[model samples]
Target: MTKQYSLKHIRNFSIIAHIDHGKSTIADRLLELTKTVAERDMQEQLLDDMDLERERGITIKAHPVTMAYEAKDGQTYQINFIDTPGHVDFSYEVSRSLSACEGALLVVDAAQGVQAQTLANVHLAIDRDLEIVPVLNKIDLPAADPESVRQQIEEVVGIDASGAIACSAKTGVGIADILERIVTNMPPPKEPEDDLLRALIFDSHYDNYQGVMVYVRVMSGEVRKGSLIKMMATNKNYEVQEVGIFTPSEKPTDSLKPGEVGYLIANIKNTQDIKIGDTVTSQKNPAPLPLPGFKHISPVVFAGIYPVDSSDFEALRDALAKLQLNDSALHIEQESSMALGFGYRCGFLGLLHLEIVFERLQREFDLDIISTAPSVVYKCLINDGQVVDIDSPAHYPDPSTIESIEEPWVVCHVMIPSEFLGTIMNLCMDKRGSLEKTDTLSMDRLLLTYKLPLNEIITDFNDKLKSMTRGYGSFDYEFDNYRESDIIKLEIKVNDEPVDAFSCLVHRSKAEAKGRSICAKLKEVIPRQLFKIPIQAAIGGKIIGRETINALSKNVTAKCYGGDISRKRKLWEKQKKGKKRMKEIGKVSIPQNAFMEVLKTD
Candidate 1:
């Protein structure tokens, strides 16, 4: 028989940590100790069901599972684990996860110490006023220094770690102690009245058999099977077909009571009807007021997603529609590229999110897609006192109509070793980062804060940081505001015809070098034709950089070997004239792969 817990016995908490800090591994061990999954069914990262998630060793979606455990106090308590993505790109989802829980398991790596994401999540948990229980993971490793990490957490994170549980999720050692700490240290949900239905949709995903399945945390009343429920945000109603909890898998339940986390499936056909963070209530006895919802998150990075073959345009759109049902952060619109054909201009939280979405489109849907260079939305103020937001390069307005442009800026925090301070500062400066402040966290560690352009950090910033710091440096960033800058639209022309795929907004100072680099790369990718093709990078009417792809050489004199010298000269003259005429009229056809390669350059 399934065990039941009262409101006081239910502990809703989430695991928050840095990427690759064993959050998933710890979740697996928790399931084992609680016996939520049978020993025969045990596997690594059991909750990460997606193949791409396991292969990448990262959590792309937020998952909540309930487990019944008998603590050292001889009391059976129900625990709901909200597993979240560790990367900064999904911090908004992490925030949503926190709001659904009463406490958090602040997992830290014993060897890696406190990272940028660790600090960022800790602050978020604190802001939510959730009780935090610090846990030191990977204690079985040879390099594990639990005591050192504990002290660093105390100093940097401003949390008392003297009672932090030290254990290795890999070996399952000290697993029992961690569970005990969760029940003893973390506060349980308050007693909820069984009056009106007030459930929050924390996360959701689409089910082929069940349609849209919403993962909700019941705040009050109950959601029972065969009951009418209404989404307070969308004002859409549905007949609840079933309600269930995740024992790492969706197990059907009769009803989800107050202060419990579980799934609710209705006959809802449209994915647009369900909104994340919206409140779900019983239509019969609706709650007086809906729960506070989260702020609408906007995309930080914009890119054009075009199918390799134009025939798959509809398939790509359908795939994105299904994917967006699970990922609320993705934003998309219809876009047409001159070289790439019909496609969508998509916006993502960050570069990783963008890559993950594309990977899913290819692996899950089996569609070939080409993504243009990732760009940020620029706020353009025209000379006629009009403001416009440009998300795609193709939509960039004429430069003659613009007066000024404002680009998004971010406040970044970098935690690094003191010795590499000089190297990192110079690297940040090269990326247009301005140092705001610096602090000595410890004898060996330093924290540096900078105000940088969001565009600068979205592309390969973290990878470059790891490269310079030998993989020891960590950083987190948040949007600060938009700042006016000297920005210009960069357009690439092949044979005097503009290619929309090779257009972007760049700062005026770096336009020359960037244009030169782009033109040089085009010269390499664009195939040699019957005539020399001139590639030019132009801003407005002024050409900043240019390159020429030499035409294919022909042996015009080969057929005149036995003829006189005049015959050979005439053949050469005819070839030159023909080449000149072809150069004037020949249209450069950029292959799909060539457009993909050119965008990847620089």
Candidate 2:
């Protein structure tokens, strides 16, 4: 069913910025100004619908909404606004969101200027060929200096940022100016003949009632209700049951056309059916050019996720599957442990993504989870020409494997005030991070780059860095391949038994410090289940340090008022039963908190 529609009245764009740069707040103001969402209906960061995102005040996923605004020239245009996640962990999602836009609103905090993630996202936007409209956000703040921010943008990004709009998304100052620039500076959607129906799936989520709802940007034709569409990537076809537009509020529309962004409801049931960047075209006459798709995002960090109640494994799986539908970047698999029962091995882009997923799993689904310390994938070679990926501690090759092992390295960029440079540098060096270069971004700010092992960064490196800089520093890293290094495996043993799950790899020079810290933290967290538990970090059977949890004592004091002699005997029997129920205090194994102890680097 093909429908004809008028063209050239639509503009699609996305907002990109580092975390806490007022991206979501700016989007809210835009929605309010366009009258897409009512003034009274506005909530802080309305697009951040996830409970975890709301609580954390960070956008974890990209959300799309359509708004209509009449320009000062009396021309009305429909603007499809996409709000993207600012964290580096969601960089792939951000990139996909940008693909649907012709331009992006690059928001930078006037006071914070361009941080590490800001530079990373700006380069991504440039790579996608999206026109950038720089906006100096938070200008109303006392620390804001729009001129200095503009100079930083020009110097770092090489853009003529002289006329960048200075706006306070919180106060609505210069907001209209920002919107006007979006309309005038952003090019209208490209007009292509409706020869064949072609739409690009930038994002999708699963709905229990509607099945899979796909968010797509139509590139070359009309997609209407009951049309048969094929996902080019998977060669899967589905009949569109519904076509609609999102106002941040869903509204059913008869059809969607070229350059318009909207959603399609089909019988598609699985996320694998509609992958991000897959092209949807008419099964009868598909488009000739395949849509340009980015590489599949690979998770660089891995962690163990266990349900608080071992019986909740099924519930956890269901929750994770549902989350994965919207977040294609999240990966999970099932595994069993003698201690933790059934749990999952989850893959995440980085530490931030890992944290967000766990938070959402608990907050949204009400599934309490115990997440183990995060680890990065390591590549190792054995003496017999064998190579293996060590994602979990259990998979780590034995120390006697007799061949070299390489850990992933990253190029990290840290931006901090000049005063804390010495402290921050010392911390990085202690973590086996080598300073590669340092440059002054401003008279009082410095940008330092370090080549650090990915394993080190995956642990408490982030927390330590923030603490060292007094929370005034921002950092981002990208994998810079692997490097050969002198690495030592630190094994944790309990009761003379090696626990592979509690093992970690560290630089030989820092093994003693790292081991002692890990053991101490473990002692504080791992409770005495039934018996006292010994936490010892060892290298080649030689213990570096050890901590022991005292065995828990059980006390039973019950009344026996019955006059019957047999009743008194029964009471004594009941006391014995109670003692038996007290999980054999000396042999109870590990506690739930032990899994979380190693998560904190500091």
Top-TM-score structure, candidate number: 1
| Candidate 2, 1-602: lDDT as tens digits | 22333456678999878888898899989988998898788898899987777777788767899888888989888888977888887777778788888999889999889988988888889998898999999999999999999998888777779889999999999999987898899988787865688888888887878888999998888999999988888888889999988989778798998888899998987886677877899989888876786466778898889887988989999999888887777889888766678899999999988878887788789998887778777788889988887778667677897498788999898999999988999888877889999888888889899998887777777787788888889899877888877777888787667766677766788788878888888777765654456778898878998988775654332354546788767666776666565534435356666665665543
Candidate 1 lDDT, 1-602, residue by residue in tens: 36668777888999888878899999999999899999999988888889988998889887888999888778899999988887788887788788889999999999888888888888889998999999999988899988888989898889899999888899988889878888888888876765788898888888888888998998888888898999988888899999999988899988898889999999777666777778898888888888874566788899889889999999999999989877767888998867788999898998889989999999999999888888898999988998999876666888888898999999899999999999999989888999999977777999898999988887778888999999999899888999999888888899999887888888888789989998998888888999888999999999999999988989988776585799988889999999999888888888766776777775
lDDT at residue 568 of model 1 (Cα atoms): 89
Q: What is the lDDT of residue 262 in candidate 2?
A: 90
Q: State TM-scores per candidate.
A: 0.93, 0.87
The CA lDDT of each predicted structure is 0.87, 0.82
Q: lDDT winner among the candidates?
A: 1
**Model 1: worst 10 consecutive residues (lDDT sum):** 593-602
Our model 1 lands, by Cα RMSD against the true structure, at 2.7
> Candidate 2, overall lDDT?
0.82
